[model samples]
Target: MQSCFFSTSRTTNDGSNETDQEGSNKLSKDKSIKKNLLHENIYTIPNFLTFTRLVSAPVVGYWVLQGNYTDASILFGIACVTDGLDGWIARRFNMQSIVGTIIDPMADKTLMTILTVTLAMQSLIPIPIAGIILGRDAGLILASFYYRYISLPEPKTFKRYWDFSIPSAEVRPTMISKVNTAIQMGYICLSLLAPVFDFTGHIGLDYLGYTCAATTIWSGASYVYTKDAVRILHPPSNIKK
Candidate 1:
């Protein structure tokens, strides 16, 4: 997640609604909340662009798998451009939202994850490199949801899909994590370009693979070892000591 990894502060609604509500009440409340959030945040230009990037992920990966490097590279570049533009617009125009904060990196991650898998399947990238990226992200995502579930009151009956607040301010990115993402993106771009065009001697897509793996692992470990993420996710309640 290139976006902010840490929320500014920690908060908890310790209150609980143990009693069940009527299905109608639950559905109406869910619809009402979704209506409000979408009305307030979904219509923004930055978010719209972000959504475009999200939509582009599968298309980009499909092109890669089909061995259409030209189209894949072009679509990937467009997605990256849209990502950059959304961030700039959001910050420049003060259009930032909790939704943006969460979805921005999610879009990036989704695109990269899909691309990585597709490329790895085609042997463009090493399995270990792909593993590091996917593994770290997979674990972290589950962790994010776990923490969010712990921090909020999960509805008994399903309603809105986007009614998640777990990817909150606290779930932020680190400097190295951000750099790792950039390098991974760069590596993918270079990898795709290598097939279509000639590049200089040793553009280092190979060596960069190891670098990404190490950094991805370290970034995940750093989050827990540095006590920033673990304290928030697990806390001291379960500590035997």
Candidate 2:
């Protein structure tokens, strides 16, 4: 009878041990799944809106270059609207992502670059002002590449580097940078529609150009001096030693 009692006790303990082990494995899997979800939540509504801006950029530029000002103005208006809407949605609905930080500015820069060049080609904006805007964007683009490379995690291959899901850095636009972007956008939108309203040679447009140039310079300098403009989340594997 004692032997039977001992055997029963051993069987019960073995079953309990197996149950505990399974529970631990299940918990670990759950934690891993949650971590991945938090790491790569890129398909949010704000991101989609931002994507629309990207797609609209080249179309707006094409229309501008083809002398389709009315269509270009309409598309530019839509782009501007999406630009503001995306940021608002991101803030309002808590759908912000690291990818949003990277691509939002990217879309803005792309639009600015295309329009700046096209408008310059048409002599809508002063050549010097266009050069200033393009130059500042060029410098910022170079800095972004360097920061991204240095902040990326181990095995920084081309694919992973472009894979924004593996976010390694966050870009917090400086106050001056934000103002500069708004001013720049307004200037570009007005430039696109100037022909429609016969406002091409207005003195106000020249004043706007001067303001845009000043803000462009100030904002570029702000990025240089601002300590927390770019935050590196992961130290590069190259310097892991």
What global local distance difference test value does model 1 have? 0.73
Model 1 quality (TM-score): 0.72
Q: What is the lDDT of residue 45 in candidate 1?
A: 94
Q: How do the residues 104-194 of candidate 2 rate in per-residue lDDT, one tens digit apiece? A: 9999999999999999999899999999999999999999999999988767799988888878889999999999998999898899889
User: Which residue ranges in model 2 land beyond 4 Å of their true spot?
Assistant: 1-12, 15-38, 235-241
Winning model by lDDT:
2
- Regions more than 4 Å wrong, model 1: 1-40, 153-157, 164-170, 198-203, 226-241
TM-score of each: 0.72, 0.85
Per-residue accuracy of model 1 over 1-241 as CA lDDT, tens digit each: 4459743433336553323234457767767755443334546899889999999999988988898989999999999899889989988998877667667888998998999899888788888888889999998778766655554322422443356432223456777888888888888888777778865235476888788888888888776766554333221232221
Model 2, global lDDT: 0.88
Model 2 residue 102 lDDT? 95
